[model samples]
Target: MTTIGIDDMALATAHHVVDLADLAAAAGVDPAKYRVGLGQDRFAFPAPDEDVVTMGAAAALPIVERHGAAGIRTLLFATESGVDQSKSAGLFVHGLLGLPPQMRVVELKQACYGGTAALQAAIGIVSRNPSERVLVVASDVARYELDSPGEPTQGAGAVAMLVAADPRLVEIEPVSGLSSAHVDDFWRPNDSSTAVVDGALSMSAYLSALTSAWDDFAAHGGAGIDEIDRFAFHQPFTKMARKALRRLATHTGAALDDVLQEATFAYNRELGNTYAASLYAGIAALLDGDDDLADRRIGLFSYGSGAVGELFTGVVRPGYDRVLRPGAVPDALAARVPLGLAEYRALHAVQHPSDVDLTTPSVTKAPFRFAGLRGRARQYERTA
Candidate 1:
């Protein structure tokens, strides 16, 4: 019987940003088609020297520096954009952050739901071993073919969380409801670099899975929809989340207020979709943006393609404000270098070749970067 939850959290986005309006103009579509219709403004795009591992390490380094990594017993990385099939991305993060070698390191893949799965596993481990600390990092680069239907949702980022007993930010309630199905709403084949998504079907699947999980959660004595002080959803886009929340509110007879939806979607609109990192990023954004959320009940709904959904609740711990700095999220967003449509396409077109002994140019300004492929192994380095 231990109280386990998120102790500290941090996030990182690529230094490059692409405005949706520019994309719309290039595609011969109205700006409102992306800004108003889809509820997205811009999204982060990783440079040639950045990928999931580099972004993941960049996010985790701040947490490790603040909390110290000596006590961490488990490091779990979740992503759909893994650099290697066999090797865990957590290992790279461990090395970059200079963590102790004694901890268990592994990667989890369940699409966007992977992060929550890792978090739940960490909670279980910490409950069994009170002294153990777990670090869960979710990072991904959502890419689709150029001019494809799913291109506008593309984004790159990471979110890292340190989980332990008596957490300073939020305490997980342990009660959760989950639903899973073998649906090919979205997936990427082994040989394909970009994902194939059934947009309409994926939206349907997301809403359906969410409803099932929420229903099960309420049946198992979870909090009522109205009773929760805040709600955060795994956001592929702001409009998608808003639609799902409205549907959930209608089904449960709860009030779907504009203020709540706006609060939850504040980060998604700015960041686009981080795939596995989206949910945690939303939570971090909420913590950083609102000062009144302290000691409030917050509900989280996580959904992944091909497809899994989970509903869980946590209480925002007292002094949560001290764990996050005000304006930190906004400042990171503001620091990105804006990319024009042509510039974005050129950057996106650069792909790593399998046979060449290539070394990536020092394109990314971040401390951690993907050095390139040397002997078919993904090489990464920490910049001095």
Candidate 2:
């Protein structure tokens, strides 16, 4: 059997921080709406120099180090925050990770579903050419600008998945997916700093996509909503995901019992939404929870815009615990230095220096930093 698995995984985030309580006050909303209602606590605060590339590389480094450079034949970087319009982020990541040269490097986009799409592509490459293994990295810095409705929900982080045959993580199950062209749910204009989202409409669109994907998957003999061992979704926000859950459970009569919605949201609640990294984060949360998922399968629904969606499944591999980050995620979430409103505002106002000298002082000990810009090219340095 052609089995593909995750060899390792990693994650990283910004140093400075914004506590949700203060962010809620600034947005003129209740803190619980985000902290409790949305299931968030902190939103990672990125420096002017760092973006998705740096964060993405940081998350993958720990895993790449564990697996080494020999077997990797493909490097895929998935992100909505593309640093360059023409260039692939994978090239930079390849250099950052010190991988072998004989590999395919590419970048993919499909909203939050980018990483999952990359993962699917990697699986195909491995299944067809058994000698090859693929590295799928997802990273993003979610920013909604100051004072926008999405400001309080913004977050930054990355996750890396090492996919290879006869794997140790989980096997990707075949499932069908559905997509819709909803102009209002989410979008980022060329010149816009903040993403535009129609909250109510986007919530509606997510459920609609879920319905269609579930129907198609079920028709293909895939697991129905009730049969899924765990449901991992894109963490747009606790409230938004909850709305989709209500719709899903109501439609299928299945209850949400995997991870406590509060605890699941807590992971993202403190970190905010990682854009393309959100769904993978959800998967990590479910795996880390106390659910009886052994011999069971997980269903993943990925959605992104400009609009695309996919329903996929994976089985939890034995010894998955050994490869997990092991309290690293929770530790990272807890180590955040909550910033006062004034500090957050000032930090947010700072922009990336035109000629930043990357070899500067270490602002945070998070193992990731923006080294500098060379020939107008951004550089990311991994300290740990």
Candidate 3:
């Protein structure tokens, strides 16, 4: 069997951020509730012109530019915040990145687990056809009603991964474990822009799914918790992930060391919840912070509300550190303009109208922007 896994990865976040302190002050709450209790410091917010497709393209463009898009045989876009009800966002991303038109393009939605599902499918394809390559992108804008309990967890970003044989970043193990249940931990109806979540129920569901998936994984001869060098979970928030890890540790009777815990959540603390993109962003964060991860094993736990869970393993390839683009994530995060309470509210209020003459906001400085609607079709353009 061909060794199939991630060849390269990249991330993109909105150029604007809202500090939790500002949000707390505006809500008449203590900052520690968000910063300490939730383990979130800041969250990214999109400009008027940014959405899942644009953000997905932004994250993928760099990979296509560096590796060339000619070899790509498939493109899978995973997101719940899709712009169209009929069309797949992958088509838009393929056009935006100038990828080969002959490739298979499709979209997947199982909430946040969609990305992991795409990755797993991509690996299967590549493993069968050694010459084929697949690009999987997970992008989302997590939103909730204003002043709601889920507000601080809202964020926008994307993560793109190129999967192929002899991958440079990591080698995905063929075996994986998955658990699924029909539950309403979180859901967004077709008519609603914001998601409805039962926080306590969601947390219970997440930890339960993690435990079941891990158990199934171990039953299938997967690595034990003690043997894994790093663990990455679908991060709705940092504290949630930490709680899940603690649960895992207790289940396995393995100690969850401070370094491992810190490495798992550093990015989620700053970026908040990115929905489909969170787990991969956590992987990228671990790679960015640790220089000695090459050849190490990583345990990945992916969960999506309404609800599905997967546990998988991958081994970092030698010299995997060199595959990460220097200053990509750091530069983007550093460039973000922190928003005050009023500015944040104003930004959030700017919505895309379906039948109006919408123009690109001058404030949108991201490489890719949603260029508004034309003939009821969503349009996007690359910034000059």
Candidate 4:
């Protein structure tokens, strides 16, 4: 067996999440639509200068620095939020992290499912070449203009996972998934800033794709939801995760409500939905909230619209807490500066780069920043 291990995982999100209450009052939306229906209490908004590359680097730094470079041989970045169509975000991150120059690097794109795909691919590559290790990152910003129907769920962030032959985190199991082509949910046409999603239709597709993938996984592992210790779904919204769980509950003889008792509003409630990083964020939340998670088997479901989905499982290893970045989660989230409605709208309206001076001094942002936009490109600089 080609055993794969996850050495460490890290998450980082945009500092600004306009209050849902503020949004509801401004847009005349019932607060429950976001609070109960979507299970979101806060939603992140991307700064004018921030892009996926910077977010990806921020997410991975804590984990990579903790691991200390020795065996990481590849850097795989999965994102839909690329700044340049021609350049790979991995290259930018590799240079920023000062990774060894000899490492293999590539970028993967599949909407939100991009990150998990990178993780799976890295596992396979390392499994075949046991001496080699891979670094996989999934980062993106979900944008839908302020006060739009999709506004309540907007978020930005990234997660980085270092995969090796022997990981200190969860072990990636050989699993199956489904991919389908659909124009039902996506952001296309290079001119638009927001994604157009058929919300109800996308929900159906998530369930449909999960059904197909789980059928294949059941055939291979003979383990169903009843056998797994936890289920982490792509957190597009709190409600969507619950819906997917109910779909899985039907076959695995698990209670949808019971399976998601802790997941409901406890984790992503404040974080909103992070595109590629959503599932990983959920994993982090669960790990932090539960003390008895060791040795538990977790079912991870990831979906991206335009649209693809997967159902996979991993076993939480002993000492998962010790291996993970300590206190990073609470610190990152708490460090954010909450935006007022006007401040959020202004920030969200900041256009993508043009051939202009986008680089500014890092006096306003501490630790992380979009740095500046210049020459139609974004420069992400880390403050010392």
Mind giving the per-residue lDDT tens digits that candidate 2 earns over 1-384? 777766567767776678878877777888777766666777887765467877787788878777777778889999888877788987888887788888889999877878888888888888888777788999887777788667878888888888888777677775656665755688878666568877777766777888777777777888766667666777887666676667667777777655234434556766788878888887777667634556567777787765667777888887777666668888876776667889878877765544554444456665666676676677777767
- Please give the TM-score that candidate 2 achieves against the real structure: 0.91
Q: Ten residues in a row with the worst lDDT in model 4?
A: 359-368
For candidate 2, the per-residue lDDT at 209 reads 83
Runs in model 4 with CA error above 4 Å?
A: 179-183, 251-256, 261-267, 361-368, 373-377
Give per-residue CA lDDT, model 4, range 214-287, as digits (tens): 88777776466677777888988878887888888786666756555474245477777777888888887777
Reference-based lDDT, residue 327, model 3: 66
- Per-residue C-alpha lDDT of model 1 across residues 156-257, encoded as one tens digit per residue: 899999999999999999789889999999999998889999999999999999999998998899987777888888999878878887888888877867
TM-score of 4: 0.93
Whole-model lDDT, model 1 = 0.89
Per-candidate TM-score against the hidden true structure? 0.97, 0.91, 0.97, 0.93
| Model 4 pairs in collision | 358-372, 358-373
Q: How far is candidate 3 from the true structure (C-alpha RMSD, Å)?
A: 1.3
* Whole-model Cα lDDT of every candidate shown, in order: 0.89, 0.75, 0.88, 0.76
Q: How far off is model 1, as Cα RMSD?
A: 1.2
**TM-score preference between candidates 2 and 3, better one:** 3
Give the top-scoring candidate (lDDT).
Answer: 1
Number of backbone collisions per candidate: 0, 8, 0, 2
